[model samples]
Target chain A: MKRRLLLVSNSTLHGEGYLQHCQQHIRDFFGEKVTRILFIPYALHDRDAYAKTARQKFQSLGYELDSIHEAPNPVDAVRKAQGIFIGGGNTFRLLKTLYDHNLVSEIKKRVLEDGVPYMGSSAGTNVSTVSICTTNDMPIVCPPTLTAIGLVPFNINPHYLDTDPNSRHMGETREQRIMQYHEEPDTPSVLGLREGSVLLVEGNKATLLGTTNACLFIRGKPATQHEPGADFSFLLTDTN
Target chain B: MKRRLLLVSNSTLHGEGYLQHCQQHIRDFFGEKVTRILFIPYALHDRDAYAKTARQKFQSLGYELDSIHEAPNPVDAVRKAQGIFIGGGNTFRLLKTLYDHNLVSEIKKRVLEDGVPYMGSSAGTNVSTVSICTTNDMPIVCPPTLTAIGLVPFNINPHYLDTDPNSRHMGETREQRIMQYHEEPDTPSVLGLREGSVLLVEGNKATLLGTTNACLFIRGKPATQHEPGADFSFLLTDTN
Candidate 1:
């Protein structure tokens, strides 16, 4: 079976309710096929509270959500999950937890071989890519490695923002950070997803969806932008 | 001999020339006893250009700065240097280069045991701490470990910014990031150094210096703000 993923830039937009803007897209992506989702709330500290919020949201969208933290056997939970949803928080913490529970390979097997539907928001989106090198989160915790699920051919930088020319902050901008990643040898391409942006992938076809355009970055080349309805299928096959 | 360090939050302030904002502090930290300084320009991509920028700045301050990358023997140069300066860039790239060149322990010994004066800006400041877990830079590359020089007992979050109430960005604020760091077990205290802020440590004495205030985040405790002249000496020995 082919891989399927819905990578969201953020959980909520400014002044919007949680997942409100992307509710329709979420519904359409999961459809009637997935009546339940295995939620991974490891990115956040308060697992109970994080799960509660996500459970309510998914419930309202006509799906049952079960947090992996509450599971007696997380690997078994992934194996039985019809869908997987990873929430946003600190990427390091989430990835570390996944390793601690030995769920990386199990989840990968389910998503890749069984084609279990997968959806990730922010830190969640980050872990589905080649590596978590492009995440904007602090490395609050250290994982054994920077490797991720490799659900996508390239890395995903969620919550990507454009440089504010008038601002005086001296830190590297989002684009500059991605540029630095490109400097490393054999680094894969990176997709910069702006607020309210989502990338939907089904088999070999990938589409950019939501309110904003996505920035595609390749090594030795300037970054290019894609519109909401743009086809990103080429990204799945292009290794260079 | 006392461990001497000047950890700056940034290399340059808004609308200022390189190191112009902290030139006086650099002078006071090095003093007349230190005539030449060894420069580590590994944080950035262009070693030659980074070295030139640092060399000229240190020269204007009456110190001869030699780029370690250009030295015949990098570790030997570190052993002979009166002062060490690590310029700011991507923290991951900087730490990886240090490990690749086998300079971590060498520099740590020169500063902690030999009492050689150490100055770091941005990425440099992040690496001088216990770990790079609190840095704001993207993880563009992977180092062997997030372990740093441990010159101080705590982590340093350089270029830390306060949340803007007017902004709508949903990403975690600098305080939130450090808070997450505090959530990790056995994690050290984190100092959030705003742009134009500097942390000066001479032996057991650590002081907050420069134009901005520094925020201290201790586990399970509310973060406290310190003024420019505030003494942070307790941070040198406090493990809790």
Candidate 2:
């Protein structure tokens, strides 16, 4: 069994419904084999409400969504899950909750070892990287560590925005922030996934999906943009 | 000696020189009696370059700036400093460096108890609060703790921007992020200091200085905007 993952930059595009933009990709990635998904709604403040919302969305897509918060044993829930979905919210809160519940390793084992299909958007996509260091979410809570489940070789910066040439905002631009991230010693490359973009990975292959271009941040080099449908499997190879 | 502090939202406004917009406020906060200032350039990646740039800026303001990086004894440098300035870059890196050098306590003691006039902008302003939890900077590096020098009762979110009603960007607005910060149990209020705004604290009283209005984020309440020169001293009292 191969490691299958659908890492979306955001759950919804500007005018789309919940996960509407990536619905086809989600269907194709999971296929007809997986009927149920263990939903991790810990990233959100209202876990029950978030789970309820996600459950409706997944059910509309013809899959049963069971929230881990409702499970008596989250670890056992992950162990038995055929597919896993982590919703978007605060990355720090999500990581902290996962660490607090000791579900990090179980989720990793289920996804990587047991070949359970994994899907995440926004905060969910961020935690699938080498570390949540590149996430754009506010650090509302401090996790035990910055280490995350490295489903992918590189870090994912979800909701990556281009520098607005006409804007006078003094806050660091998305590119500038990613450049600053590279300043850290031994930092890995980062994928600036634009809204509506998805990184689909199967075994050792990774492909950039969607209509927009994704920005890539490499250490000691100028950042480059990759168009949709480009092969990003090279990112899996250790750059260090 | 009363504790005097100048917390600026940004170092430079649009098309202005470094610290150009707030130079007058800087001089006013420190006064003519304080000629020599100790500078902390740890927030930036290029510490030496950042220090040199800030040194020139302070010199232009008629004060000698000595970077702590160049000081043989950092703690001693903080102890004997007439004024302290923390230049903005990345808040996490700044706090980490301070914690690594064990300068958090010394700087806190000097600014809070010793009445050595302290000035900070952007990341600098964020750290002068209860914690760096409300900062807008990317977490490039993880500090030992999110705890920062508690110079003020509430946290500061510098370079805070108003939500653009016309914009289609799906990223959370600055206000939304601050509200999410408040979602954490018992989190303090967050002052959304916009660009060109300054928070001037003298002992028990804090005033909102500069030309623009600053937004205040109190838990479970609608965020309110405060005009320039507003009396924000009430923030010092226990809100929880």
True contacts kept of each: 0.87, 0.64
Runs in model 1 lying further than 4 Å from the true structure:
none
What digit string (tens of lDDT, one per residue) describes model 1 on residues A1-240?
A: 478899999999999999998999999989998999999999999999999999999999999999999999999899899999999999999999999999888888899999999999999999998889999999877899999988887899999999999989999999999998888888988989999999999999999999999999999999999999999888899885
Query: How much does candidate 2 score in TM-score?
Result: 0.98
Tens-place lDDT digits, model 1, residues B1-240: 479999999999999999999999999999999999999999899999999999898899999988999999988999898999999999999999999988999999999899999999999999998889888989888898999988887988888898899988898888888888877788888888999999999989899999999988888889999999999999888986
Model 2: per-residue lDDT, tens digit, B50-106?
A: 988998988998999899999999999998999999989989999999999999898
User: Listing every candidate in turn, what is its Cα RMSD in Å to the true structure after a full C-alpha superposition?
Assistant: 1.0, 1.1
Candidates 1 onward: DockQ, in order: 0.88, 0.80
Off by over 4 Å in 2: none
Evaluate residue B34 in candidate 2 and report its C-alpha lDDT on the 0 to 100 scale. 91
Quick one: best DockQ, which candidate?
1
Error of 2 at A114 (Å): 0.7
Q: What is the TM-score of chain A alone in each candidate?
A: 0.98, 0.98
